[model samples]
Target: MRCEICGKKLVEEPLKIKVDGSIMFTCKECSKFGKIQREAPKPQRPGVSRSSRVTKRIQRPREPTEEVIENYRDIVRQAREKKEWSREELAEKIYEKASVIGRIESGKMVPDLKLAKKIEKLLNVVLIEKTDNDIRDEMGQSKLKGSTIGDIARIKRN
Candidate 1:
């Protein structure tokens, strides 16, 4: 075993201890980090075999849900003015910088999904529209089969 804090290989038995509420085994030298735990909670077992432990989970690729509207700047500016709020007031409401709000309203910077949603809620606007129903399938060729990350990273010395 190795020390969790220092990563040094321990020649002796690792000290069984707890950090916070979590139980951990650390080397003797690194045991001073947390208070020694008297008894760690054990998992309930009913004598199941190791072969039953292996299980697989299926994961589907995530579909894009939202897209920013074309005239986002005009929409945001109009909505903020409708509420009679200054750039600083709007930024404080949304937890963002006043300069960022100005840039967003002036069409200099496009807001990401999270910020856009917050703005939409505060200003009562539809800055983004859901696009999960209409999937775009314009992807071209797939990658080659056999190449690995290590293969590309190896230096070619002549």
Candidate 2:
């Protein structure tokens, strides 16, 4: 499909989704201006109803369960530990408050899309695995240069 904002091409990948049913359809480069207004459903009326009766169906946005959010936090924390990086080190690398990292790892709070992407890039792991529900960062895709704790250790020696 084409980008809703730039009209550019869109690959078969996920996009960042907001709680209000707003989906970002373009690449991250074009996401800066991909603000599409959410269209509300029109009210419906039953033909059999003689009286003036309008039925409106209100759809609530999807919300991640507490358990699922906690799972994501654990995944991030485990990835960081696998890298043998302390909370302070990760915080410094991601340019976030150590307390924020601590809270996220402990499942005290959920990271916004931007913060989640930052952690994923710095940790070099798919902390937030893609599901039917996830904000895709096409431009922020990163690969571990050489994974494994040994490789990381060797890099520090140089």
Winning candidate number (TM-score)? 1
Model 1 TM-score on a 0 to 1 scale: 0.44
lDDT of each: 0.66, 0.58
lDDT of 2 by residue, 34-106 (tens): 4532344333545523222333111322342221233557667777887888888999998888898899898
Q: TM-score of predicted model 2?
A: 0.40
TM-score per model over all chains: 0.44, 0.40
Over 1-158, each residue of candidate 1 has an lDDT whose tens digit, in order, gives 88876788989977777788566778877788876644532323443333223221112224555777666787777777767899999999999999999999899999998999898788766677645432334332111111212222221110
Residue 54 local lDDT, model 1: 28
